[model samples]
Target: MNGLHLIAELHDCKCAPRLLRSVDALRELCLTICAAPGLTPVGQVFHQFGSAKAPAGATGAVILAESHLAVHTWPELNAVTLDLYVCNFSQDNSVAARSACARLIDAFIPERVEQREIVRGSCPK
Candidate 1:
């Protein structure tokens, strides 16, 4: 399947503390972004990590009909990494993928961003 994949590395995010450490908050943000781009959400899973000796962080993934969106946050470092992939099997979903990525970036309010786009599963003519 032909698809567009976006990967982003965020540094120095200034979002609220809860957003960076809470699994529920991250999950909600992912779901909202998915809806904003009209991506179908089949299911989702989010996990929180850290202990008293360490700083808390979160990891989440939303399973979409077209593909999936995944995110990981490091509160101690004020950093985040995001991945969004959409298969264009039936139609072009590049726009939707970009929109979702933009929404995520807006929410994080990162001071520095490193993003890349990759075209996957292309067939030779």
Candidate 2:
């Protein structure tokens, strides 16, 4: 796998307890992740839908040089879904992606987490 894409399903998150209801928090997180070394954010957008009182959640994506990072949060459930994708490009950016991802996960401090890594691009058959 030359490139790496990480997906994490966070359960019972604590860092952004109220962030699930605030699109602001979600956007901030995305921006922070994109600021990591080797990442270049091209564009970003956030969405809020659901109950007016409680707020459904926040969903958005940040386009990066290697690829992109997206996040979705559910305040009511104290759960969040996160994705970090970085291509090897000229060199290996996988380590950078993982380091950046660790920061995001640290922020959530989820009680339970389901994470996976997928290899992208072509290498050896």
Candidate 3:
């Protein structure tokens, strides 16, 4: 399944209050963004690390029919990293992947973003 993979590092992000702290909020955002790209989400799992006294951050992955999307947020540093990958097994999903990635970046509102796109799996000869 040839695909496109998008990776991004966001610095000085000004995300919504719930986005950085609440697992529910982040899950919703993932689902919403996935839908925007017409990706079918099979399931998802998110975990919040650290103690109640001093909350750390959240990390999660959304399993898609095409591939998957993963994200991690560092509230203390106001930073985030995201991964969105979609396979072209059935159709070309590169555009959808880019659309989803763009929406996520917009939500984060990062002052500086380091991003990259990689083509995964070679085309059939």
lDDT comparing candidate 3 with the true structure: 0.89
Tens-place lDDT per residue, model 2, 34-82, is: 6866588988878886765768888998888778898898877889899
Clashes of each: 0, 0, 0
Q: lDDT tens string, model 1, 1-97?
A: 8999999999999999888988879999999999987899999999989853553999999999999999999999999999999999888899999
Give stretches of model 3 more than 4 Å off.
51-54
What 10-residue stretch in candidate 1 is worst by lDDT?
A: 46-55
TM-score of every candidate relative to the true structure: 0.93, 0.88, 0.93
**Which ranges of candidate 2 are over 4 A from the true structure?**
51-53
TM-score for model 2? 0.88
Global lDDT scores for all candidate models? 0.93, 0.83, 0.89
Give model 1's TM-score versus the native structure.
0.93
Which structure among the candidates has the greatest lDDT?
A: 1
Evaluate residue 25 in candidate 1 and report its C-alpha lDDT on the 0 to 100 scale.
Answer: 91
Q: How does residue 57 of candidate 2 score in lDDT?
A: 87
